[model samples]
Target: MSGRPVVEVIDPGIQSTVQAWPGRTGLLAQGYFPSGPMDHLCFRASNVLVGNPPGAPALEIDKIAMSVAFLEDTQIALAGPEGIHARLNDVPVPIWETVRVRPGDVLRTANPGRPGYRLYLAVRGGLDVFEALGSAATSLITGIGGVEGRSLLRGDVLSALPRDPVSARRFPEALRPRFTTEWELEILAGPRSAPDFLTDQDWSELVSLPWRVDLNSDRVGTRLHPHRFRWANGGSIVTGGHPSNVLDDAYPVGGLLANGDVLTILGMDGNTSGGFAVIATVPHCALWKVGQVRPGRDTIRFRAVTYDEATALNRQVDFTIDPGRVQVL
Candidate 1:
């Protein structure tokens, strides 16, 4: 846990390597949104597999390819899209599972496909990056968090927290998530704008029509194609401060809102305060699923569920390692 080890970046991936903690929490305080992995559930699952606590600093890679060599032995996990080809000493490795490596091993990753955007990499003890505003998560737009609020680049040597030799074990294959399935997102009506902003037709279109993810999507907000409705209160709204549920405060991750006449799906890195009307809030459990969605190929459809049903489904999911079978290398 002391005297960090060096992790050299031989190649910077398409996107920067970002990290973040839980972020600040208080009444009437505007906290910086920690935009890390698009699929945070998988990110957290990787951390827990390697015995790291939730919210630990992990590497978040976007489309750009990356190549690095470790200075010491380490345990790591690669999760997210299919393009990421993580390797040890030039040997291919699998995603969504933990792998072991010896000192001087080289780990390289490539883009999953054209238009690819993100990848999540977690080390045994997590990366030892600086924490600002109570989080290590990077905010690219605001230029805050992660290596001076910027993306990781070539020749950057990141420090790693000391590892626990005893906890260095291979992750079971059963624990990995299937990356090749279509993603479906569930949403609830927004606290403020949902009631007064979107017309009935807009709401119906959101639930019934299939919306394609536009190439313009990013960590800030996902721009979707035009649906069949107009704003009940027009496209613009007065600026104000609100809470997670309130449109006047700041929007939270999974907040579905319209931006500049186009339907945008806001992620964790969305602005804290805005005047735009909030349409819906993607539940916590569904946030990761939404993040895994690929552009053009993915379609988002809303399904209504009762609170009890949502809770039951969330509880049914297993979030721990099975300790049953070993992952084939």
Candidate 2:
């Protein structure tokens, strides 16, 4: 087998895209959204396992079922919730650890055995893709970065950066995230809520029940069922017809847009600004769970927290993954 450095996409499976650390930044005010990997925890873990610096560009596969042919020998790794079925040259491959791929070898991933939605694969030197807006992440909505800004399709080919050989490694089992159907996200009170836009009763109901994910969800955002909320003013003073509409303003990373009984959480590829009222915001640390939730199967609950607490959680998550060293960013 030749040691040439190329990968051929045999099948794109689902919404497979190239993602990197911190994605697109410093452009949200200009109507640009960061289109990086949905699950940062898994994405970073995969990169570290393959000897790439944390936040290195990698493949973020949605719903599994992708196939590729390696034209060169290299080291790779996969990281995500348990239950993914992956194989190299028809032999089963383990997740969370680095493995060697020989030239002309076929690598394929089947249905994920668990409930999560996104999975990550990282090569030793990171995938070679054009960087747009200082990132290689693909935004399906804007079509801006990473492989012409879309998911991988049949016949797609990717190049790997040249690097000195590195020893294979695995992340500690205790540090890996466990996948589950139920999720509890810690949220902070939104800017609009400070003026009492929502009543006390509304907040109680929001956290009291588990909400199912709608099938119509996408990279831009996902809708939750049974919104069960109204303006505190009892439907008076309509905010531009729909109860959710408000003056357009810059949106946060995880804006909770509400329109009467319907609610949608802004995701990594969400719009920069909108007319919807943001009822609450999910901190950066909890966003990984939002990306891994499966539509029509997963459910979510939000618990309110202070901004300080949210920031602390972010640091905690980072320390849990890579404690003793600074990220290369």
Candidate 3:
């Protein structure tokens, strides 16, 4: 605990946990993944609205009903997919904006239907926590950060680091994040494709067909499927039993990893090293789209992009998230 007590959880939504921005870095070799918010842009927007640093610890709600009681007066902000259900006590509260609260005020949210999956709630000061590996992000699979490295539970109390009072602010409406049923994501083709693995035809098909997000998808990875094509050279790589197995190699954080015919986009809690083959990498600029993907409803199409192009897109995204863009009220 690093500051004054601020809130108590009344309802812990599915997979809800404490998380911060840009999570633990330079420690992947220790088998710890940066279990930060699924949507970095949303995470930053929430923090900016409440006058907290971008990396301030906050609650990452997993698109389900949640409720919390304020233990003290403070300002808070919520951000996520465009149309979310939320409230302050009995009054409806706006999303992507800041709201002032008093002691005993209750903030609650309902399920975020198909539009998206995760939401962020940030206080005036970042949440108080003993940073594990230098972050407050939670790794549910390995019990790494967050409250004991697990999802939040009802009755949990939260504290916030002391910070100066900040006035109201909101993210622009035109710039808010949008969600759709289909997406065309760009990837840099292959650290493992080509004449040795994927033939020219195989490479063509990987990006041609639409892949649907599987229901089994989780924070660790977004599993995709169609089950229509067989790998042309999965057996060409080294293996223990499966054709897709290879000597364990550093896993590209947002790369397209293949285990047999199954395709997955490594996400926030995805592994750092694995024996599975990484065929293509989804650029960091485009990975936030992966966070909002709706299971069983969203479909993805891949396009090959150059590294320079990806970098340019990332810069564009950065501009959209700049603190100066916030509307002061």
Candidate 4:
């Protein structure tokens, strides 16, 4: 270790704290769900900018503002909305790119102009926090991960690990993600909902109609405007004991499931086991794109893509950001 204290949280803004990959298998084994961040793309982007390896722990912030002060000089980057601004000793800093800051400088966000929910802050060598299972993620639902599996509060401090000098030196020019109004999420139909409950037209409408995001949405799952659909059965499925599916049937991360009273679009932080009817799943490649949409903005539309296309797109993205560029700092 470099003997440098990682960055510490001065004010855990509106809802800011450290998160890493996630604890999935163990959580599911214990009947707990895996709840992480809403936008993994932005999270990974910040990590890459700060020269941290993929899956390294980073900070996740909600609408509320947060202030972080470094214990030592460090290189860092911010990804997500411009509303979540950063200041070094009160000097304004840009988002989506790398910048160096000295100790005692504070970073924070301003009143947001756009409809964004989360911000990710990453530093050189990643943030140092106790890992649960294999990640540092905070699963609020089960009260696991992070500082006791809860949101960061005031007066909380975080430490950092030493980074390789070579990684720190490879800092690239600041790059910001293109936030736009044109947001289209791709979905794959699967796991069938009651088999008979959904008609061809209902499934068609799901992929065709524009559905607005409900205001009561969060990291766990997003609820969309309801649409009429029929179900063959109204009973619950038995929860089984399988390596992956404890809920009896196998389902994808972004699966669209219907419970007794709600229609939810599962996101990255969805439950590991559920008896809800599964209609579809959003492709991993297109998951981050949904973060750009604001609540009550307008009904969002889903486009259906073949499994081959989804796989191809994901592979292309991985190729675009080569791990070789990640130098040890």
Candidate 5:
């Protein structure tokens, strides 16, 4: 029905954008936000199912209820916090596994209002979109990559890069990350977790309690409620008015940043540097949990972990996402 193998957007869902693996890198120092997939495990698994190499461009959706039409034969897969409902040509299909489609085939996705969060869609070949700063990640912060650097809109067309098809596959059930509202994140001390600002007891309370997710949370930063820290300096700095204030510090992607009385979990599109103090940094392995969590409804508690332990956990996650571990269909 078309010339090049293409997918046409029928209804672009909210916050839906094209993303890729290992997003913009080595350039954050020069002011680029590394806007990649929110859920790395789900993103990676989708690519593997479709036989795409790492860095292949894929679609990311939040509260997905979108529709797209295929113009040719290709393979596709979906993955995320919880597999949402999808149908191909009005026939039910499943997530976390490869599905075949041909010309005139339409794929529609929607949530049942239960547990799904961020969802990813991958084609046999990655989507054909422009690259910015050597990446295809669409950073809404700067609007520099992917479909003119913005979330997808209806009538947008994406052609698949030239690639051969691969066999069908799915992620292993036992190895899948458990998506939940109450997230227990493993964190390590940050640069400003010292006694000069926050006391030892403050650090203890930060890790020991469940923090409420704030409605203000977004891709820039996830906000948390009730900043109940007993500051050693009485919320005062040499030139600051708030207890969490400190000199501008280089931002960490998963850092726990204090902004006034509200705490934030710095995200992919968050600030590169700021005046807030970062008391903890969530490890890469656990950051996916942050990406899938529901703001204004969910809660999170911190669990302190050493650097060595974090590294081990990352390795374990890597091993679990392997294609060999999932079912062969």
Candidate 6:
């Protein structure tokens, strides 16, 4: 408690893991995924509230009950789309603000008011965890980064770097994000998503209707229903047995894949390379919203935008809240 801050996990909850900046550059070719927080915006905001750098390591949790015991005195912040019920030592603790914690403080989190999927917790100096490929993100598929390269388990213990306390802080109401169930995503057609991949008629249908979120969705990707498309006559060759399969290639974070009859939009822990065809890529500016789209509850419709328009929206969103704390990509 004197030299380093620590937290003991009584119940790690669902899919909780320590996440930092994504894997190092040029790592995908070697099959390493940049498995950072799915909601980077909230992750950075939590760190900022604690006076830490934007990319400092933090705990990311899904919508599940969790409890932890603080073994040292420090400052911590929780940031997310909706304020979940939390208590310290049986007293209600506020969200979106840094709160001081002392030894033996029992912190519990649960009862989400909304449908979003992620909640982030950031300590003042960041979590102290092993880094793989120059990142602290935990890849559940690869078992490579974070604590033992897996999700937090019961009785797990986590620590933060030793540092003098920063001032307790909170973000103004106007700066926090409000989540919704119906999402309209602006997309940019990727290299593989040229006009010829799908017929003009199919492209129209893709943008015109709301795609249903499937229950199979997870951190790896969000599976969607009704992604079938018409192929242009002789427009392209069949890359594999399935019409959607192509030569395995690198996939962007928001790559929309035509896997069989359904589709999947890649997430933070998505594969670095795959055989499916990516019809579009979500811009970094609005990519975090993908993480909040609760499976079987929220639906999304894509709106194709020009490259210029995508860049402009990116800048606008970044400046609207805590400017200079987040990057466009």
Question: RMSD to native for every prediction?
Answer: 4.2, 3.3, 1.8, 4.8, 2.1, 3.5
Candidate lDDT scores, in order, read 0.66, 0.81, 0.84, 0.66, 0.84, 0.79
- Expressed as tens digits, the lDDT of each residue in 240-278 for candidate 1 is 322112244577667777654567778767776675666
* Model 1 misplaced regions, further than 4 Å: 25-28, 82-84, 112-117, 167-175, 193-195, 231-249, 313-329
lDDT of 4 by residue, 141-228 (tens): 7677778888888777776677653344332333334554445788887766324556677677777777777877766777877665
Better of 3 and 6 by TM-score: 3
Model 4 residue 298 CA deviation in Å: 5.5
Pull out the clashing pairs in model 3.
none
Query: How close is every model to the real structure, measured as TM-score?
Result: 0.83, 0.93, 0.94, 0.83, 0.95, 0.91
**Residue lDDT tens for model 5, 243-315:** 7887776888889998877889988888888788888899988988888888788899999999999999989
For TM-score, the strongest prediction is 5
Against the true structure, candidate 6 reaches a TM-score of 0.91
The per-candidate count of clashes, in order, stands at 16, 1, 0, 14, 1, 0
Deviation in angstroms for 234 in model 1? 5.7
TM-score of 4: 0.83
Off by over 4 Å in 6: 1-5, 233-238, 320-329
Model 3 vs truth, CA RMSD: 1.8
TM-score of 2: 0.93
For model 6, how big is the CA root-mean-square deviation? 3.5
44 in model 5: Cα distance from truth in Å? 0.8
TM-score of 1: 0.83
In candidate 4, which residue ranges exceed 4 Å CA deviation?
Answer: 1-4, 22-32, 82-84, 164-177, 193-195, 231-251, 296-298, 323-329
